[model samples]
Target: MESWGNSTTVTEFVLLGLSRNPQVRAGLFVIFLVMYLIAVAGNSLIVVLIVVDSHLHTPMYFFLSNLSFIDVCYVTTSVPQMLVHSFTERPTISYGRCFGQMSIAVCLAETEFLLLAVMAYDRLVAICNPLRYSLIMNGKVCIILALGLWTFPVLLTLVTFLTLQVNMCGHNVVNHFKCEVQAVLKLACSSTRINGIIMVLASSFTLLFPFIFILVTYGRIGFAVLRIRSAQGRGKALSTCGSHLAVVGIFYGTALAMYLRPQAKRFTNREKVMAIFYGVITPMLNPMIYSMRNREVKGALWRVIGRKVGK
Candidate 1:
């Protein structure tokens, strides 16, 4: 089938970011750079603490470490280039590079979704079947689930990239800070039916299904918490899941708003703005959410820093 919408003769795309105003772009660059540094430092610290702290060797921290690693990859996939482009007069991306960015972003995003789902299940088992929690989420099982979470998304992203390759020629202007899948797909000169289908399927698997799982798991957890007589018990239970819930809400909310929403040319600017929430802000927030609210992570971070300072 012929590609949908207008066809361009160029192979690569030019990213027209938020502002052409030099002052505005300069300010954005500085702001994003600061955010990027914070994201890297915060997420990296989480990963380091998880590795060093023997107390954090459980399934929960296993998933938390992986989530931190994914966040690092997630932000790195798009943010630096975006920061540079914000300051540069002409921001151009090669077709291959665009595909690479999309592939990495989609893979990491989907992986995080799957990881979050696994975490919810972990929480469910811990709450609902505390005795069998260790059996169900043994080291072997955790490794297998984490592998699947990471690999499945990589495969899906590859398929999407192949699908896009068939129709990507000319009119390379991408009106966003990064080469988002939907935005890039809009520039294709070939039928996007396959791409759309794949995207929807991936979204369903990665976003909708996991969301439902988290809701159900949390519902069960809520019931379990209610049954506990001690107020401390109830508070502890809520505390365990609260950060994950917040991260889930922010990440999925912006992601769905950008991808699942109707595609209109007029919404491009709005979409780009929303993309920043998930791509940049969420990564930066995850570490803070866990560090400030999570007792174990905070303790581990403090210990690590204290050791470093002593050294």
Candidate 2:
């Protein structure tokens, strides 16, 4: 153990993952491994499809590629660490490494939230002001928005991380598998009130704000769809936003369930399961949800595959 600040000693964290039972661990390993593989393959395919298909060279797919990339990063942050913990009898993380993991996880999570918000707004502009969609979401504007989404998370994570550094001293046995902000803070010998407050505020911005924006955007969209005189027109417009709505529902529903309440020791296993949904399962599902349901994406993917096979 190493002393920090005044005289507090900090060492490593013990990650209590899914199960101690070998059989259970094996089962979970298989399940999670499948989820991880799907997440990587699905998200990668989306990125490739978007890049190679000229038909997908639009602001929507541009945002989607970014979203898929973030999803890949997001799942990778936690799942691999958890997998290691599950197999190994003794799993430990160094203080510096734990902090770094926490920082990256939080940053990527916030980035995903911001990206979702940007996508929502893009849909809003596309649906509400169809004529102005091109002007509103031009390449330059998209780049600026994307930069803002990426930068804000790093700044927010830095603030939270700095606050955490002050508290990280003494036996760091993080009960959770991953380096969660709450789990790490619980190990601190020093005061963590400031860290808790910052977490709540950041969570509000990242989770709740995007949720509200999505709700309002979709509410308006629903009203607009109802007003369309032709059923075909309404169907067409609704189809455009359906995939995004599905993604938002899954991502936000799981996130709100996990973070809306106070962190509890008893619910650690439950939290881990829920974390799998948003962090791993959702990412895997996003590409499939969009590609399978959306005609344009499916068409583009088919064409790309056909071209490759031909060559």
The global Cα lDDT (0 to 1) of model 2 is: 0.80
RMSD of 2: 2.4
Every model: Cα RMSD to truth: 2.6, 2.4
lDDT of 1 by residue, 1-311 (tens): 33322224555678889888999888998999999999999999888888999988999999999999999999998888988787678899876677678778888999998888899899889987888989988999999998899888888777665554446665577888888888877876676666777778778888888888889888988898889888897788788888889998999889877777566644367788889999999999999886667888878778888988999
1-311: candidate 2 lDDT, tens digit per residue: 22222323565677777677888988888888889999988999889989999998899899999999998998898888778777799888876677678788889888988898888888788877889999989999999999999999999877765554454555556667687766666666666566667778888988888889889888988887788898887888887788788888888888888777776644466777777788888998988886667888889878988998999
Task: For each candidate in the order shown, give its overall lDDT on alpha carbons.
Answer: 0.83, 0.80
> Candidate 1, clashing residue pairs?
3-189, 3-190, 3-191, 8-170, 8-171, 9-170, 10-170, 13-172, 14-172
Per-residue lDDT, model 2, residue 64, is 91
Q: How many backbone clashes does candidate 1 have?
A: 9
